[model samples]
Target: MSTTFEEITRPDNGPLVELNNNMQEVFSQYRKMREYASYLEYELKQKDEHILKVENENSFLRDKHTTFDSNGKSVEPIIT
Candidate 1:
């Protein structure tokens, strides 16, 4: 009986089974790390947007609180 190249290269009967196994494990770990990094980037972007939104709202509120509506003048002393 003669062995074909496909049969010899098949995963189940490969000569470098151990190397293949290690490579698969390393690839899996790399994928996991990439997914984790993607999630972290999304989280950071969301946090940054949230912070900017909150800061803008805060600035609006502070301006409204300090400015008098009667004459459109600020009641608080301007700090130089």
Candidate 2:
């Protein structure tokens, strides 16, 4: 007597499709994060410029305070 065996094939599930869609959403979120970081860098540069300008102005004012009066007298002390 001879016995015959049948081969079985497995069916594909839909979970793989959902995973691909989720990966696409993650990539989109990553792009948005990069854009936000770029915007922050630009803002920081502007703030640095403003800070430099203020420091220079303060230095000029301090120098002017060191000058004596027309009668050759000392001036009042100014807070830095």
Number of the top TM-score candidate: 1
lDDT of 1 by residue, 1-80 (tens): 99666545535756588889999999999999999999999999999999999999999989866856578766885789
- Residues 10-76 of candidate 2 have per-residue lDDT tens digits of 7676788889999999999999999999999999999999999999999998787776788978778
Model 2 TM-score, 2 decimals: 0.62
Q: Estimate each model's TM-score.
A: 0.67, 0.62
> Any residue pairs clashing in model 2, and if so which?
none
User: Taking the candidates one at a time, how many backbone clashes does each contain?
Assistant: 0, 0
- Global lDDT scores for all candidate models: 0.87, 0.90
Best by lDDT: 2
Least well predicted 10-residue stretch by lDDT in candidate 1: 6-15
Global Cα lDDT for candidate 2: 0.90
